[model samples]
Target: MTVFSVNHVTTYAYAEPVRLGEHRMMLRPRDSNDQRLLEASLAIDPPPKTLRWIHDVFDNCVAVATFSGETRELRVENRITLEHTPFEGDEFLLDDSARFYPFAYDAEETPDLARSIERHSPDPSGELDRWVRHFLHPGRPTETGELLMTLNYAIKEGFYYERRVEKGTQSALETLARRRGSCRDFATLMMEAARALGFAARFVSGYLYVPDCDGENRHLGGGSTHAWLQIYLPGSGWVEFDPTNGIVGNRDLIRVAVAREARQAIPLYGSYFADNATASTMDVEVRVRQSPSCELPSAPHRNL
Candidate 1:
């Protein structure tokens, strides 16, 4: 079991001060088998007059608060200590998942996922077609660890991660054409690619305690969240892979929830416009610490 100190902070600033109104929040994590939640607390500047907690389709904690004016400042922070216990390692892949995920026998109406399979047909675009080709080729790797290592190298070898918010439902071909994507886009593309090749891949959203991230960092879930992809293999179970960063594993992944797509995994997301005008601003920060700075666990294998 690994112990970690995780903290997250998010604040928003408006272009101009206007009459503030009621605000809704979906900023808390829900229960899941992947990660255990120890404790959580939320603070809002110019505190809200009323707060009503609601659960979304994915069962995430959503809060609605009444505010008086525009330029409202909101902050959410969570402290959690959890362990991986039985991590899904290289051995798990060869025994169970390798056989189960590669066939389309188990696609169901999973309401929790935002991106649905509108239609299932052969992808003509070489984009996913190529990845599928690789996934299906003989000599498939023996474990999830090898899959992560191989994918990390492939993404880094193909393109670079620049700053930008990916828009719309891009076909696997479209993402392949661009060779660039946001956290959600990258993870989505990976999920599609995995599914195309017959793998049970899910989306995950939560905090990643990175030392280099300062003040406020851009969100993978974007706007108000962070996201990544998870693949289930036997014995190993579900393991996370951050195609954006190229290096996050059982040792680092602070999982909040696992669902079908980025939308379901978002921390705070809803649609509401008071008047004819639409307006919104978001801020986010993340911090990670280790007590005593004792001997570190084994470092993850480097990407090729």
Candidate 2:
């Protein structure tokens, strides 16, 4: 088990004071059997009139804040400390029924996993389908785990990692054509491709702990909110795959939220009232590091 500290700060600047609408934030880590939430806090500038926290459909902690006044700049900062138990894929035992390629989920589990198995978009172009089939040769039998691991490494090796400053994610087809994308695009591509091959997968939005392997091997999508995906194997359950870093299982991935699609797992979702011509810009900075070395600031009270 390893402990880590994560700080994420987002600031929005407007030309003039703007009335902030309700802001729903997914910044807290999701505690599970392998994870323990030690302490978490959120601090916002120009305190909102009312603030409440609730769990969303995916059971992620969502902080909803409403402001009664306008401000020129809005800042939302979050600090968390948690212990993440390392997960070794080798330790998981797959049921005999699902040990081979092209395996099927038991009838009892199919109904509940149907939504994840269905692709978010139809692969009319068949571009993604062809890409995924490359792993399984026409006449050769493939190991289920091997096929999935190969697919994970294939994306990391085949595509270029580009930092996109734009809002929203690119389509899987777009990423394939360009052979370049941010972490989210890569995750979406892998997720959709897995679904096309009859695997149940979902989008994951979280933090990545990147320790320097070497200066030349610096990881991408570390100092900001990162995106990845998880595939549910019949016996192993939901296993994480980070094509961005060619990482299998949880390893250095700190999951904050998971959803059926990328859009649903967005870290920050909100709006502000301003003139049609009003121009604004948003800046986000996230830092994740091993614990005890960095000191964290005091967090604001949960109540406004």
Candidate 3:
């Protein structure tokens, strides 16, 4: 088991005071068997007049803040400490019936996984279908797990990683054509490809913890938020795949929120109104560090 302390800070600067709209924040990690949240705290500057917590469609904790006055700057800071038990690989062995390619889910499990199995983007040109077809073999049955691992590694090795400051992700075809994209773009491509192959997949937004192994820094997508995908198998359930790093499990993935699409899992969302010529800028910083033997005073269960 490993413990970590994560700090995330976001600041918005405006040329003049502006009216801030309701802001939604998704900064807390969801509790699961493999991970436990010990303590969490959030501080917002130009404090909102009202703040409330709500669970979204995907059951992610979302903070809704409404402000009555205007401010020249807005800042949001979040801190969390948690314990993560590394899930071993052998623990996810598939059932005998699902060990090979082209397996079916039980008749009872189809409806709930329907939305995730369908592609969210337009594939009118059949580009995505053709891309996934490259992994198929006609006569020989492929090991399902091996095929997925190959596809994951192929993305990391075949494409270039580009850090984008844009607000949204690119389409799957757009990323495939350029062979370069941000973490979210790569994850969307992989998720859509898996869905085209009749697998249920979803987008995951979280933090990547890069440890100092051998006193060298060799990991990507660690200094900020990261994106990946999760595919559901019959016996193994939902398994994480980080195509950006060719990682196949939850070893370094500290999940904060999950959704059927990337936009639904944004860490922060809001709008402000200002004069047509008024300008604004945003800055975000995220840091994740190992807290060897540190512990918090209390375990809080409050939301937002």
Q: Which predicted model would earn the best TM-score?
A: 3
Q: Which candidate would rank higher by TM-score, 2 or 3?
A: 3
Better of 1 and 3 by lDDT: 3
Off by over 4 Å in 3: 213-215, 293-304
Q: Tens digits of per-residue lDDT for model 2 on 1-304?
A: 7788889999999998788999999999878987788999999987989999999988988999999878888899999999987763335567877767788988999998999999897679798899889888578767777788888889999999988878899888888889999999999999999998899999999998877534443467877899999999976889888998887777778999999988998888788897655778989998888765533222121100
**lDDT: worst 10-residue window of model 1:** 112-121
Error of 2 at 99 (Å): 1.4
Query: What's the lDDT of the predicted structure labeled candidate 1?
Result: 0.55
Question: Which residue pairs of candidate 1 clash?
Answer: 19-70, 20-69, 20-70, 25-63, 88-236, 92-236, 97-234, 101-198, 102-198, 221-226
Q: Tens digit of lDDT per residue, candidate 3, span 155-209?
A: 9999999989879999999999999999999999999999988999999999988
Q: Candidate 2, TM-score vs. the true structure?
A: 0.93
TM agreement with the true structure for every prediction: 0.70, 0.93, 0.94
Clash pairs, model 2 backbone:
none
After superposition, the stretches of candidate 2 with alpha carbons farther than 4 Å from their true spots are 89-91, 213-217, 292-304
lDDT of each: 0.55, 0.85, 0.87
Residue 111's C-alpha lDDT in candidate 1?
Answer: 33
Among all candidates shown, the one with the greatest lDDT: 3
Best of the two (1, 2) by TM-score: 2
- What would the TM-score be for candidate 3 when compared with the true structure? 0.94
